[model samples]
Target chain A: MQLSARNQIRGKIKTITLGSIMAEVQVELPDGQQIVSAITRNSVETLQLHENDPVIVIIKSTEVMLGKQA
Target chain B: MQLSARNQIRGKIKTITLGSIMAEVQVELPDGQQIVSAITRNSVETLQLHENDPVIVIIKSTEVMLGKQA
Candidate 1:
């Protein structure tokens, strides 16, 4: 499927922390970098995400902040 | 500074498309993956973001979707 989102990172599920309504997912890239995402618990179940599963992290935000070092 | 956002990718600015209120910034990673971000024009000026600038992309979203191939 085509998405308007421009950032697409391929990573493996490293951990999953479930809450009452939200779930925190940690995705580890091949280069040893980890990306954490907070998603709805229902979407987590719908996606059937689990540890060691290969998945793509799709992020679309209206506020992508830029930071530079001084 | 510390941020609550989980995903942070280091990349260089490749392109910038500015509008009256919002702006589109394209960041290219080392692995050749491009991540696009939409930010307000005020932020663009505040951060002094421009092409070829090295910056970190910070994304915080409540809806980070996961997609798996069948």
Candidate 2:
């Protein structure tokens, strides 16, 4: 599927921690870079996400901040 | 600075498109994955972002969605 946000990285599910209303999903890339995403528990159940499952994390925000090293 | 968001990808600024109030910045990773971020012009100026500058794209949202291939 085509996403407008443009940042698409292939990662495997490393772990999933569920809370009452939200769930945290950790995705690990081939380079060992891990990206953690906090989403709704409903979405987690809807996506059927589990450990080692391949996923594409979709991030779209109007406030993508930039940082520089000092 | 420490951010609560977990998705921090190292990328270089590819391009910057300025609008009246918002700016669209394209960041390219080493693997050629391009991430497009729409932020405020004020932030773009505050961050002093420019083309070819190293940056960390910070994405924080309560709505990080997931997708799968059919």
Candidate 3:
């Protein structure tokens, strides 16, 4: 399936911290960049995510915001 | 105001394509990577964004997703 999200970076799961209804996943890029994602608990279970698993980070262009230094 | 978004990258606005109620912004990173953002026209006006303006790219963690190769 095709995704409309503009950002799709490849990374490895560094960690997954589960909460009541949410999960925070840390994805480490090959360039050493780190991105934290907070997704639904169900998504984690559905994806069967685990540490060191290769995954694509998905972010929609509409979800992006621009801020100038104040 | 502190934003809950986990990703905030530094870049400069490259272009702005305005529509009836929305606008698409292209930002170029220091490393020449580009990020596209689609936002409300009101937000563009509110922020008064312009080309060549230095900006921060903000994305909420909850808006992030992970996809594994099927």
Interface RMSD in Å per candidate, to 1 decimal?
2.0, 2.0, 1.9
DockQ of 1: 0.66
Off by over 4 Å in 2: A61-63, B61-63
> Which TM-score value belongs to model 2?
0.87
Provide C-alpha RMSD values for all models, in order: 1.8, 1.9, 2.2
lDDT of 3 by residue, A1-70 (tens): 9887787878899999999899999998765667799998898999899999999988889888888776
- List the candidates' TM-scores in order: 0.87, 0.87, 0.82
How would you encode candidate 3's per-residue C-alpha lDDT over B1-70 as one tens digit per residue? 8877788877899999999899999988665657789999998999899999999889888888899997
User: Model 3, A50: alpha-carbon shift in Å?
Assistant: 1.9
Ordered by lDDT, highest first, the candidates read 3, 1, 2
The superposed Cα distance between candidate 2 and the true structure at residue B1, in angstroms, equals 2.3
Q: Point out where model 3 deviates above 4 Å.
A: B29-33
Could you give me the TM-score of model 1 versus the true structure?
0.87
Residue-level lDDT of model 1, residues A1-70, one tens digit each, is 8887666778899999999999999988766767788888988898888899999988775646777876
For model 1, how does the per-residue alpha-carbon lDDT over B1-70 read when each residue is reduced to its tens digit? 8887777778899998999999989888776767788888888888888899999978774546677776
The fraction of reference A/B contacts recovered in model 2 reads 0.70
Residue B16 Cα positional deviation in candidate 3, in Å, after optimal superposition: 1.5
